[model samples]
Target: MHNGKPVVLVVEDSPIIRMGAVDLVLLAGYEALEARDADEAIRILESRADIDLVFTDVQMPGTMDGLKLSHYIRDRWPPVKLIVASGNAILEESSLPAGSRFFPKPYNDHSILDAMARMLAS
Candidate 1:
């Protein structure tokens, strides 16, 4: 946690979507960190131990996509929660890291916030 608030890393290749996710995270009372792609997100994750959760988009221009990133995080930072989103890809439940949640594009802000709250609470 950062400054007594949960720290969430929002990873999206699209600037607009990243900004919107950051806004939602901040509005939900978490400290928001932004990354344009999986590589950047990995750098941040490596440097920060206070991050409580990751909110990432599936499609990205990077060495690894969000699915791979999620798997990496699960293996390396097991304590962190994950919320993965994708507009086009149809992900299977088994494809996600254990305990991670998935949401399609145009996900509800309220629902995301609620999920974050529940994940953080647990």
Candidate 2:
């Protein structure tokens, strides 16, 4: 946690969506950080040890998309939680690492917030 609050990294390529996600993270009462793509996300993850969760968009312009990013995070930082979303695809639970949550596009903010809280609480 950062400053006694859980830290969440929001990863998305679109500025508008990224901003909204960051706002949601703040609304959920956690510290928020952002990255536009997998590479930048990796850099941020590598540089910070306090990040407790990652909320990422599935499609992005980068070496790897959010799915790959999530797996990478799970492999390298096993304690970090993941929440993956996509407008274009609905991934099965098996596709994501264990304990990760998936949300469809236009997902309810309250639901996502609840999921974050639940995941962090575990």
Candidate 3:
């Protein structure tokens, strides 16, 4: 096994979106897991305990949205890197916490993979 490769967790309400994200991550030579929403994301994160990064959407139809999900992850896994992905202006218009990243929708796969590489590197 590759010891230094990142472990990615993708959280998107839409199955299509989640699957697409996971495919990209896998293609990039990283390990990946998926969740339909924040709840599922939390469950997976809690269980795996080795996730290095999370890619979440800001807008979701669920009890916990992406912003709240990011906060929850930050609180629980302070060392885990977080990446916010969405087409929502509200999330992008505001500032993000230190060490976190945001990528607006319609993001290029190469760009996202590059960013993930950088995040995991740190």
Give the per-residue lDDT of model 1 (tens digit) for 1-122: 87899999999999999999999999998899999999999999999999999999999997999999999999999999999999999799899999999999989998999999999999
Q: Write the per-residue lDDT of candidate 2 for residues 23-78, one digit (tens) a residue.
A: 99998889999999999999999999999999999999979999999999999999
Ranking by TM-score: 2, 1, 3
Poorest stretch of ten by lDDT in candidate 3: 89-98
Whole-model Cα lDDT per candidate? 0.95, 0.96, 0.84
Which model scores highest in lDDT? Answer: 2
User: Candidate 3 residues 1-122, lDDT tens each?
Assistant: 13677789999888888889999999998898888889889889888877998999988877888888888888888998888888865464345655788888877888888889888876
- For each candidate, give its TM-score against the true structure: 0.98, 0.98, 0.89
RMSD of each: 0.6, 0.5, 1.9
